[model samples]
Target: MLTDTASLQTVLDVCGVFVFGLSGGLVAVRRGLDLFGVLVLAWVAGLGGGTIRDLFLGITPPVAVSDWRLLAAAVVAGGAVFLLHGVWEDDDARPAGGRRHVTRAVRLLDAAGLALFAVSGALVALSRDAGPLAATLIGGITAIGGGLLRDVLARQVPEVLQRELYALPALAGAALVVLLDRVDLLSPLTAWLAVALVFVIRVVAVALDLNAPRALRSTPTER
Candidate 1:
């Protein structure tokens, strides 16, 4: 019988940030980055999405700046990755297949954070009186914004824009959130249910190597 409240949404938002932050740190580790890079990537990945969402919703100052929990979560995640990754070095004291072993982990974490943020963002938008379509769009943006920033900073192509079923699942979940709210069923239970649905869809797409169809084209000649 859990009810949706400000406290719950805040907790969900924090958890999303922490999880995305971990993925950021992992990406940094995989990229041969230094400690500072790990921290920067982590914070950017964690806060980028929420900041964008807040800005889009016309919320001044953005929670990523005003909230101490977000800062702690991002910093703690970066520190954890730095410490744990060092302990995982192979015989030569280099990271034990940082790319091979950590790549799947990064994708999985991205899926998780995407689901959490999508639902949370949708709920927040609904609470702020956003229209359903606007809420859905905001949710999708909030889910992927962090990863986009992280990948750009880490010098990798963003997964959302290029491949996989990333944005679809997030948008679907946000739409579901809007639906639930409109139906007067947006309780904590339903909120989490939407999260699970989005996560499952994204995870399944990853496992099955699914992708939305792109335009058919001949291979580009050397430009």
Candidate 2:
């Protein structure tokens, strides 16, 4: 049973990896990065989160390092942007509304990937003997860490810090997982339910243009 659960978790993680990898690849292409940079970001965005989680949990060699091929498969899936550049047909030529539509599409794609990482991360933490608080935190971290790493390496502000209600949804999903586990109700069904909840929260946030509170700026005189 344990092995089965682990295997399933891995498959789900791979799916999340592919989604995030595509996001990364798209970002690279937008930034006009060369092929090497595009592939590098895709790989980083796919596995960086899980790598952070494993290292924190004292899992030696981390899955990102040991199970690299799994991440590579995701990068391959993400290579669509690079391989099908012609399909994109040059963004400048597209209408402003069209660009906005694509942006929204990417946000939805990111929400799905975030949900997978958040829920699965909590499960992994629980399996590793982490307490409720730790498991929840780890899960939240797993959801955002890959994008965080990618942004840092790319010299851009992290999305979780600036994007619309990103980290909160991940944390919410992770917390729900912990709650379910506390009640001895955590199962594959409940887990996926948590993922759905996260995704929905993100989608709503996107639709409503929700954002985290911003820091108060000083008055002009104070400045």
Candidate 3:
């Protein structure tokens, strides 16, 4: 007897996981990682956040570990990327033509996945009677943990630290979900609003090339 909203949330959760897994696989292909590496990245990106969420709630085995579907999704995504690379390797021009567009699309989808997972994670935390602050932390971690793992594997600075509007969007979305839920305004509508907020923020940040502040170059006198 799952409620309609609950069911919708479930769908969103799985969809986010699947897309995130696909993004991981895509990146692995671009990097020429082996099949095992691709699948490892895919599973980690797809399930890492949810697993953390479950652990925080003391849920046994974690949802991602317990549910076969999530693993299946990651494996399928990895296999698809591996096979597609085989087909694509024959064409030098095609990679040049499509690589940028595909990368852009993957980034946008990753943003969407982050948004959905952040809000959904907060919602789940709330449902489990977690404190608001704890819920927000859970939400934020769930949103970025996968990407962090992916970056570590790829030998890059994690997205939250180096990328455009990444952590901020997830933090904002999680906070919004908690606030709306507290005010009795968190429903399907509010969830969508939160997602849209995160998505737009991410898109704008990417478009504007927003980045985290770094140490400025020192003058010769200071150096």
Candidate 4:
């Protein structure tokens, strides 16, 4: 059972990396970045969060750096985007709907990546005997760190800082996993459910244009 669980975790992590890499590549494509830039962004988006998590845990060399398979996944995802983006592009001289399609695709992919990484990150932290608070924090970081880096590189505001409900869903999912683990109910099934929950929340939030409350204007003080 332990071996199977470990294998499952590895699979989830790899899938998350690949999905995030693809999302990153698509972002680069939307930004009109060159092929090399796309690849770099893909690698950074796929592995940036994991690298930060590993470093915080004092794991030397970071799995993102040492695991050739993860690197290959990023590279392959980037290459695929480079090869297939032209096919998706509307050859029309007008650029009207083209940007919308790309934006929608990027958001959907980002949501998937966010959900997968959140669960994987929490599981990894639990496996490493991290406390619940630490696990939740790490999980949120794992989900958003890569995208944050991607946006920064692309010269845009990170989504986490925006008015969206992005990090909330990730942290909520991570908290669910931790709670389940505390009750000794942490199974692969439960983990996947957590992932689904996060994904649904994020996607719905995006579709509905939901935004978290921002600071309201203060009323002027009467003299």
lDDT of each: 0.89, 0.82, 0.81, 0.87
- TM-score to true structure, per model: 0.93, 0.89, 0.86, 0.93
What order do candidates take by lDDT, descending? 1, 4, 2, 3
Off by over 4 Å in 4: 1-3, 91-94, 218-223
User: lDDT tens string, model 3, 72-91?
Assistant: 87788778877886666566
Better of 1 and 2 by lDDT: 1
Model 1, 15-37: lDDT tens per residue?
89898999999998878799999
Tens digit of per-residue lDDT, candidate 2, span 1-223: 2335686688769888888888777777767898889889888888888888898899988887788666675669467768875466455576575566556655776788899999888888988999999999999999999888888988877878774899999999999988998887877788888899999999999889898766689343422
* CA lDDT for candidate 1: 0.89
Where does candidate 4 clash, by residue pair?
none
lDDT of 4 by residue, 86-180 (tens): 87785645576777777788788888889988988888888899999999999999999989998899887787887669999999999998899
C-alpha lDDT of residue 112 in model 4 = 84
Q: Between the candidate structures 1 and 2, which one is better when assessed by TM-score?
A: 1
lDDT of 2 at 104: 64
Off by over 4 Å in 1: 1-3, 89-97, 220-223
RMSD of each: 2.4, 3.0, 3.6, 3.8
